[model samples]
Target: MTVTRFAPSPNGPLHLGHAWSAIVGHDRAKADGGEFLLRIEDIDGARSRADLADEFRRDLEWLRLDYREVAPQSQRVATYRDAADSLRAMGLLYPCRCTRAEIAAAATRMGPDGPVYPQTCLHRPIAPGPGVVWRLDVEQAADLCGQLTWTDERRGEQVARPELFGDVVLWRKDAPASYHLAATIDDAADGITCVTRGLDLFHATHIHRLLQALLGIEPPVWHHHALLVEADGRKLAKRRDAPALAERRLAGEDGRSVAAELRHGLLDTGISFADTLLLDA
Candidate 1:
């Protein structure tokens, strides 16, 4: 049976972009006679709020999107820790103590996630101390796993090249696990058959495919859909002042109608669907 999930962080309210992603995952699961699941990605320390978490549930209910809610990432610290320990035992994990500014200054090239880490701390014999992030050695891991490939419903077959991301972080300095670690671990644990999200994270799948191989977790097929953007071409992001769905709902917009419009790629706000499909192609 196919299983799909909509995992949203509760640090901010859901926006139209989030709505589109969730609705697509829900519809895909329904079409396949499968189950849809909701996962609260609230693992960020201190930044994630219980109030915001409640709001996330309320917003989903307001849209009438049904799903089985899984335990939030906050409750799964031990699982991530164990996974990190396993990787460390294999010598594929390293301690990185570089600050953001240091990384920015050192990186000569850029990847999808800002400046690609230069792996400055990869060989540092420094003991795990304060502000240390756990990084996975992508080159060593790929060598161990040999060539890897993953499939996307929209883009077809893909050869995984995690090296583009350099040695990515598995456990963050501030959080129990990075998004890549937590999402990959939880998806496997929840038996998710398909991973659905926006195309901005399309490159992230390469790193995820590597994690699945390294962790011995079953990989899910991916769906990297287009992103919702404004007329000026700015992608919708809370930090970028994207309108929150709750704000619209409070202003008397019908949640179900909004969801329907999002599902059909229709929005009253003149939000353009940025075609990331060609890039994936």
Candidate 2:
């Protein structure tokens, strides 16, 4: 059976963009008679608010999106550590002591996320410690996997290029697992057949595909939908203080109507869907 998930971080209240993404995943799963799962990605340590996960459930209920809840990332730290240990045993992970400032000073080009690491500690014998992060050796991992690929529901086949982001971090000093490692493992653990998320993470899929290959996990088809943006063209984000869905629910607005409007490409006064659903080929 097809399975899809809407994984949200409970660092803040849910917004319209989040609701749209959840609806897409929920509806897609229902359309195919599949299971819809909700995952709370609350592994950001002190930044994650425990109460917000309940709030997220209420918001999804208000929006009429039903899903089977999964174990939050905070509860799966041991799994992430075991996955990291496996990678380390394969000689695919190395400890990096470089700080963000040091990497910024040494990096010459930008990758999909930000300044690429310059491999300052790649060959250095850095030990795993409180201040060190674990990074995957992308070159070696990709070589072992060899010519990997994944498919997007809308974009067709994509050749995996994990090297685009250089050696991405698998484990962080502060968090139990970096997003790439935790997400890749969680999807496989949940038996998710279809990964539904926004377009902003489209590039991150390359790294995820590589992780799936290295971990001997079955890959899932991807559906990266369009993001909801503001009139200024900036994507809606919680950090930017995007309007919260809870506020709307408290204002006596009908949740089903709002969801229908989003499906029809109509949103609140200032919110608009991206020009195109599919990214440019």
Candidate 3:
């Protein structure tokens, strides 16, 4: 059976942008007679608000989205650690002690996800410890699994270029697992056949494709739908204080109507669909 998931971090309340993404995944699964899953990405440690997870459920309920809940990332530390250990054993991971400010100051050029890591810690021989992060040796990893590819439902086949991101983090010193490692493992664990998410993360799929190859897992077809953006063209984000869905619910707005509007590419004032191609089609 086809499976798709809406994995949201519980660090903040659900907004309209989040609702659109959830609806896309939920409706897609329903359309295909497949299963829809909801996974809480609460692995950000202290930054993750446990209470917000409950709010997320409430929001989804208000939106009338049906989904099966999966174990949150906090409950899957061992899984991530086991995966990290496997990669380490294969000599594909190394410990990095560089701080964010230090990396920004030292980085000479940028890549898809900001400044490419300069490999300062690649040859440092640093041992895994409390204060160090684990980074994938992207060069070595690509060599091991040469000429990898993944398919996007809309964009067709893509050549995986994991090296573009440099040695990306697999495990963080403050969190149990980085987004790349945890999300990839969770999708495979849940037997997800369709990876549905926003286009902002389109580039991250390159790294995900590489991880799938290294771990010997079957790759899923991707559907990177367009994002909902403000009139200024910036994407709606919690950090930017975007309007929350809870407010609309509290105002007694009809959730189903709102969802229907979103399906037709209509949204509130000052907010619009960034792109309509293949959205709820």
What ranking emerges by TM-score with the best candidate at the front? Answer: 2, 3, 1
Clashing pairs in 2: none
Give the per-residue Cα lDDT of candidate 3 at 166. Answer: 93
lDDT of 1 by residue, 44-93 (tens): 87878888778877788889888999998988889999999999999999
In model 3, what lDDT does residue 127 have?
A: 78
* Tens-digit lDDT track of model 3 for 41-152: 9988787898889888888888888899999888889999999999999999999999988999999878777888999999897877889999999999999999998999
Q: What lDDT, from 0 to 1, does candidate 2 have?
A: 0.90
Give model 1's clash tally: 0
Model 1 — TM-score against the truth? 0.96
User: What local lDDT does model 3 show for residue 206?
Assistant: 91
Model 1 ranges off by over 4 Å = 277-281
